[model samples]
Target: MAAPAAAISAPGVLADLLPASTRARAVARDAVLVLGGAAAVGASAQVAITVPQISPVPFVLTTFTVLLLGAAYGPLRAGLTLALYLVAGMAGVPWFTEGASGFGFPSFGYIIGFLVAGVAVGWLAGRGGDRTVLKTAGLMVLGNVIMYAFGTPYLAYATGVGAAQAVEWGITPYLIGDAIKLVFAALLLPGAWWAVNKFRSQD
Candidate 1:
């Protein structure tokens, strides 16, 4: 029954968020992407101005979107969706807050990080938690780790710093916000299930 529901309702609204095709889904995917982008921008509220002496990357809150998409959309869509996100930013969308654009420095690794971490989230949705909040939270944490791995080096090279300093440069400032987002993402899975259970109980 559960699998049937996932399959039956997969089109139109839920699964429709991403088009599996190369062309037709492009417009739909772009429109759907705006929501995720807005959410991502929302999560990272204050743009940490890049101090050239420190680093050239401005801080933003896309991680929340990263986790959200991974859990809500699953691996393939989530991964591709976020990948498109980075691509858009690279193409000069101001999506990154540099007040400038293009794929260069600090962002490269973090982009890769998003992919690495998101993979865990999407994979965990199946293996770790099953659309439950707690497991989702755990998976997100696992995925967030990949962000650190990718972000560390850019911090070091561009800022003329070391590993610890690199961590300080980017990852540390956002730690508090990231924690809160993690909790929010964790609850999303359980909350979703609760809603499903409520409707099911009506039967």
Candidate 2:
């Protein structure tokens, strides 16, 4: 017989609520999630707008997608998903922003930041950081900060600009968009958890 939901350890994320029936099935499910998550990020990357006068780094939807996936998938799956995205994109997959690939781009550091922020967000979500509006908001903010931390410096190095200039080009232009994304994520994650709980109660 399957273990009762209450008998299982606390779930790291919503995905963990659907426990696998067997060890092999669990592995298969995780593999699928990783691949699916990576594809989602890649697809979202295509939704980009570049203002050359403002920054070489195109504003993209991948940040919102990555953070949500991380909160939903938890640490291991999120990490693997982002790692796969990075490796595949570097190996000639035209999945990076605006169908670009093979690294060395001015925006490549933000891609790297996605991997790290995904893992960080997933780790926090595993500890119940995504279950409330305030906590989820903070988590999203931290994830954005992580992305900017890595991306700004690399933008500087890649374009031979000073730190202040990099911030002006790579980050300042996108602050409003980032804020909007963060607000949506803050609402969505906790709302999903509430839905999951309601479903489980009905079951």
Candidate 3:
């Protein structure tokens, strides 16, 4: 009898890892979060600054979601979900700027930067900055920097430009937009967390 009871309790013991409410809300949260992220990638895809001077690169809002998703989801989940965005875009889902499709291009580094940005934001969020708007901006700034870390190299390789020139053209041009995104994501992420926590606190 005791042996059977132990067997029955094993699943429950494993289930206790994430806590009751947190685990229970996972299904709804995952659907809302991931799908919301997908939609965001699509929306951000539209926010672009096109200059014929630099047709290959345009400023966009995807970086904003990169930080916000990481902050909201935590590092691993954020990374995985961002992977989904890239994979989808690569699969010709039109999640990139100007509804671009296909992959294996020069700008793929920017996509990689999105992944790094998510991880950076998620790492900061895991450290308890989820409810803090100011810190969220700070963290996003750092994340945007890291985004450039990955993107500059790819841009250089793709455009046949020297590393220094790539940084000047690809990374430098985007800093102002990324800074704006930091402000936006800071406000956006903490605001959402506050609402969710406030509702939960009431309950």
Q: Per model, how many backbone clashes are there?
A: 2, 0, 0
Task: Compose the digit string of candidate 3's lDDT tens values, residues 152-188.
Answer: 7887888898977887778777777777777777787
- Candidate 2 residue lDDT tens string, 4-72: 778747677978976699999999999999999999999999999998987899989999999999899
Among these predicted structures, which one has the highest TM-score? 2
Task: Give the whole-model CA lDDT for all candidates, comma-separated.
Answer: 0.63, 0.92, 0.71
TM-score for each candidate, following the candidate numbering: 0.70, 0.95, 0.77
Worst 10 residues of 1 by lDDT: 8-17
Residue 178 deviation, candidate 2, in Å? 0.7
In the range 33-97, model 1's lDDT, one tens digit per residue, is 65565446434524545665644555566677676666665566666666766676678766554
- In candidate 3, position 140 carries an lDDT of 80
Is 1 or 2 the stronger prediction by TM-score? 2
In model 2, pairs of residues that clash are none
Candidate 3's error at 62, in angstroms? 0.8
